[model samples]
Target: MPSITRRRTANVGRPTSAETDILAATQRLLVNGANFTELGVQQVCTEAGVARSTFYSHFRDKIDLLVRLATELMTSSFDVTSAWKPSEGVERLADAFLQVVKVYREHAAVRRALTEVATYDATVRDFWSQELNQFTDWTIAVLRAEQDAGRTPADLDPVSATRLVVMGGERALVDHVTAGDPHADGAFARELALTWWYGVYRRPAHHGERSPS
Candidate 1:
């Protein structure tokens, strides 16, 4: 394990096994309730059982490591979301969000680190913004499909509604995870499903219709 960790170094364009141990070790520490902001590289090195040079070569600093892990977590949640298109119906949509919640809850430590570090780190913040925007963009496409099928309102602006729904859901879900409440999951999922379904996709077209200029 030490030989593998020492030999595999990260590259600008590719991934390497050098980070595997360090990532797992950091995750273990975080899972054990280690404070991310207060955690040091040396501690990670010790837990990972790699040299300091190995850790540094794989990550610029502690935040970088956390950010990478957070990035993976965000990607995982997004993947769960992408599995359900808007046309899949409210039940499936809610199920998708539930899966997303599960993913976040599974990596609760990394989720906490992501939110905390993003407050001051531009790299993590930018990555976060981009991930949300990607979701927004993808949802817009799905909304258009529903509109084209006469399921959603004819006059709905997919861009605006998608932004509101996707970003708003993101904030709500983040809060749900941070609060560490499992009882709220079902209601929250159903609420999200209802909002996206009736609030946007299934609303009467006349409700949001506009007059001609």
Candidate 2:
């Protein structure tokens, strides 16, 4: 299967100045409490201090721009995840998760806008899911490696565990930022780290059976 992450402009790297300007502009409006659906391209271009033509050149539509923002945010989080080692203690993993939390908090507005837009937009929804699915693939690999190394228990199905953790962890991370409580961020990150560490990587034992599919 091809990676949704294999989409264009990915290997090309981060956005140029014009793209950054427009993305930053949309984030500003959302930060100021403007409804994302109510925001117009003209208003965004105006905020960006760029021409409407520039906006059109950079993005096909607002949904596209939101997807770009999501991509940037996910890339940062994935980079952090890549640094983590199963051999490292849960505290170390907590530190890695905290870095991810900081990334989300840094662009809390864009994060908020993307989630809101996704609710009513199928394109955004699928794009976001595909992005998470990409991470799920990476996570499954890591879990399998840990099992081979005798860290994670073999009883757990890596595929099923990866889906549950990736999807659930994505939602939890987004909600953690949305709640906007800095005080809870650390605890939340630690809890997530612990869940991944003991709940999967070091699970004691488990059992399951298949039902009609």
Candidate 3:
């Protein structure tokens, strides 16, 4: 939820009810296909039934508001990753990513808006990068831990592999969500889960544990 590029306000406090109302209104506008770059502060203020001064008092600008929305969306998805650990087995990891895909599906609109706004806004771009890198760093740490325990290949560079997997997984999810193929989510989730599990997390010498024919 932290802004990587925006300076912190000196008078920060818990968001007031009007602030929450403005955020909700902004979200509703975005969901209704309001162009993020085109939407004006007055428009959002009007939608929220607040004064233009009220909007400025709560947020520096539209991008700041979008960043907050993006932060909320990103944090909600953390539960998926929080449930994963190196010691819990790959099934748990797979389930975790599946849950992530579900989260993506539910918040596809807001996510798509952030992606679009990030294209032109440096602040939003940094916020997006920071959010993604946090996940990538966490995954890299877990992979390194597994490698140190001899449960994964030590020869693989954890940083590079984690970036590839994380970026690729996100690309796939974005494509599926944008495509509007609801039925494809399950398959996409399964394939992504399997790719990470067998492609990275699976140890090379597990054949001995397989049941004999």
Candidate 4:
């Protein structure tokens, strides 16, 4: 896993109802065809039905609000990952990945906006990179545990294997979601599961299953 250095902010407290309202309003605006770069603070205040000063009190800027929303989206998806147990079987793991895909679809608008903003905003890019790296770290831990149990290939490097799977899967999934083909998710999930299972975590062959030459 990579080390991440995060910037600290002075506004440190739980979000108020008004703050939630503002974030939700911003998402709605994005869903309705407003680009993140073009949207104004006053417009968001009007949509959220809050005074401009109230918005500032809760967030440092529009980018701050965008990062918060993106963080919420990523955390919600990660909540599913935290519960996953490899012993539960590959079918369950595949289902978990599918659930993450469902989340990405559910919050497509905000996600699309975040993707667009991340291209130009260094802060947003860092925040997203750190979040995904955390997921990759969790995956590496799982792979290492499987290796200890002899279910995974002992020769495999968990760090590289996990980065290939997690980082590669992230890009593939984002592309699939942006393509908007509803039928692609199931096929993609099946392939992804097989890649992790057979490609990295398959158990060694039993001598009993070998045929005589």
Candidate 5:
């Protein structure tokens, strides 16, 4: 008679090193535009150098794995901009704003692919929407702080104003990625950000105050 070892139930729920490999491989494949439908479980398992059973052990299916990968990408990107702080005035804001646009533009390929995939996919769409809202809220908070410090125009409403700024930045990036010109788009985005900052946030001169050259 052959002797068999039974697996523990407690150990069944945990992700193995193989699952981590599959997740990382899935992200790389997706970023490279690998056809998810054509690349079935066996393909992914082979790509990750894992057994088929190991792949199914961690994720319900490819979509589940893809969603997790997308979430990871968004979380990582958010971390990059989470520490943003606007300096003394509009000019400083423009500089910080350009840094963000530049980073987005550099990651244009991955961003575009994920955004396009999100359009028809409910899971991806929800993930993107939640991330966008979080980012917009952060922007609103920064603008509110600027307003309180009197660096931003007192008349501007932070909530509505921040939404407008977010929309503008979103549209700019969408257009840039769609156009296939990340460099030009980045430059234009920076200029547009500067324009919006100066137009909406700059304080008006007091009565009898001469304009500085």
Candidate 6:
């Protein structure tokens, strides 16, 4: 009798349509409240209609997939806000913040998923940190230009002040979104923006009061 030998299958490195389907399905599941701990590779394969071996061929694990999805979300947000321009003094800031809130509210499912995942994932946290820093830098540039033109308070430090202002706006929106309050509207965002401006911009000295020259 002739000796029989079995050969191991070679790994083909190219991504297949099945892998794309799995990633897309995973994103949808995440948007629908399947927490990271609950997200298993098997479940993802089931949802995507793929075999277990197929998933392993594309991704090392669930965290790796989560990192990719989170990065996409952050980059998309940056793209949406890149065209932002302030029209009036503080109103511009208010409008810009409200725009962000509106976009998040419209896609609350995905936003909530990203928020929850970022809380525990270091990679997601780093992605958000970098994105937020970029946003703060952009805001500082706007404020600095206003200061140069005598629109903003001369005593304020543009860079530090802008960070504080952006933080306030960001937190206010997060609170509104997470609160899930039925009455939550653009009013809260507008108020928060105005409050920030009041602290950063100087009011003219009252008549008969000596200007602190």
lDDT string, candidate 6, 35-92, tens digits: 7667788889999999988876666666566655544555555565556553344556
Best-to-worst order by lDDT is 2, 4, 3, 1, 6, 5
Q: TM-scores of all models? A: 0.82, 0.85, 0.87, 0.86, 0.68, 0.67
Let me know the TM-score candidate 6 reaches against the reference structure: 0.67
Tens digits of per-residue lDDT for model 3 on 5-63?
46553236688888899989988888888888889999998999999988888788877
lDDT tens digits, residue span 108-199, model 4: 87888878888998878888888988898888888888888887778999998888888898777778777958787877776676677667
Residue 179 of model 6: what lDDT? 82
Model 5's number of clashes is: 0
Superior by lDDT: candidate 3 or candidate 4: 4
Clashes of each: 0, 0, 0, 0, 0, 0
Q: What is the lDDT of residue 16 in candidate 1?
A: 67
Superposed Cα RMSD, model 6: 10.9
Model 2 vs. true fold: TM: 0.85
All candidates' lDDT scores?
Answer: 0.76, 0.79, 0.77, 0.78, 0.61, 0.63
101-202 in candidate 1: lDDT tens per residue?
A: 887777888878877877887767776777777788888888888788887778999998888888888778778887957988877887777788777786
Per-residue CA lDDT of model 2 for 23-117, tens digit only, reads: 88888888898888889999999999999988877777777777777878888998998789776667788889999999988878887777788
The ten-residue window of minimal lDDT in model 3 covers 204-213
Structure candidate 5, residue pairs in collision: none
User: Which residue segments of model 5 deviate by more than 4 Å?
Assistant: 1-20, 36-39, 88-113, 182-186, 203-213
Candidate number achieving the greatest TM-score relative to the actual structure: 3
Question: For candidate 2, what is the lDDT?
Answer: 0.79
